[model samples]
Target: DQQVKQNSPSLSVQEGRISILNCDYTNSMFDYFLWYKKYPAEGPTFLISISSIKDKNEDGRFTVFLNKSAKHLSLHIVPSQPGDSAVYFCAAGKYSGAGSYQLTFGKGTKLSVIP
Candidate 1:
């Protein structure tokens, strides 16, 4: 079973509107959650992250919310732009015994911002 899951395969939004992406995780060991945006072929770029200690984290147009009890998280983009169209992946990581971080990633949600 996938530890991290993105229920929606894709999302479409009009420019200047808000885009909300959802994710869920089954691993309670995961304390650190992150959102990444990926282009066609390039690697995913880090977007926002929230530690289990915080309920919300915001940066500019991007906001991330984490609910530890619910095992759920979401990313909100305000005034979505054409340039914001990309595939978003939700990832969770935890510190391992070997001092390494093991991460599990959701499939992805492709966001299309129509102009």
Candidate 2:
């Protein structure tokens, strides 16, 4: 089963604090992992990604860590701002899939950044 799962449906953090989001997956064939941030009524925007061969990746205020052995991943946002409030989706897929890489996405985690 190519199931990506996000345990928390929602999280709230005060501005300037750290926000942590968790995700899990059951598929071993998934070689590429991605995290997307989505605003209301808009498509998800890619945040960070990590390959199965790597343990961690970072982008500015966002960081993603993957623990392949445990099938777990997490996204950390430091100094969270109100603009960071949005739904985050954790997705996984193989690189060689059909034409476009089909992403298996978690239900989604809503991050509420308080001012």
Candidate 3:
């Protein structure tokens, strides 16, 4: 079974409005989480991230919230713009015994920001 899951397949928001995307994970070992945005034919670009030690992290219009007790997380985009429309994916990373972390990504949620 997949460790990370994004329930909503897509979402639409008007420009200058708020866009919210949710994700869930079943792995208790995951100590870090990240949100990425991807455009068609291009690789995903890192957006924001939260560590197990922190409940939230924010950058500009992007914010990532983590709820360890619920094994869930969400991303918020405020004042959304048309350029923000893209496929967003949430990923979980667990520290392996070998000294590195392995990541598992959710299916993704396509967000459309209308003008």
TM-score of each: 0.98, 0.93, 0.97
Error of 3 at 36 (Å): 0.7
How many backbone collisions does model 1 have?
A: 0
Error of 1 at 42 (Å): 0.6
Q: After superposition, how far is residue 70 of candidate 3 from its true place, in Å?
A: 0.7
lDDT agreement with native, every candidate: 0.96, 0.93, 0.95
Candidate 3 deviant stretches above 4 angstroms = none
Ranking 2 against 3 by lDDT, winner: 3
Model 2 TM-score, all chains together: 0.93
* lDDT of model 1, residue 69: 89
Per-residue lDDT of candidate 1, residues 14-68 (tens digit): 9999999999999889999999999998999999999999999999999999989
On the 0 to 100 scale, the lDDT of residue 24 in model 1 is 98
* Better candidate number, 1 or 2, judged by TM-score: 1
| Model 2, span 1-115: residue lDDT tens | 5389998999999999999999999989899999999999998999999989999898899999999989999999998999999999999987564676778899999999999
Q: RMSD in Å for candidate 1, one decimal?
A: 0.6
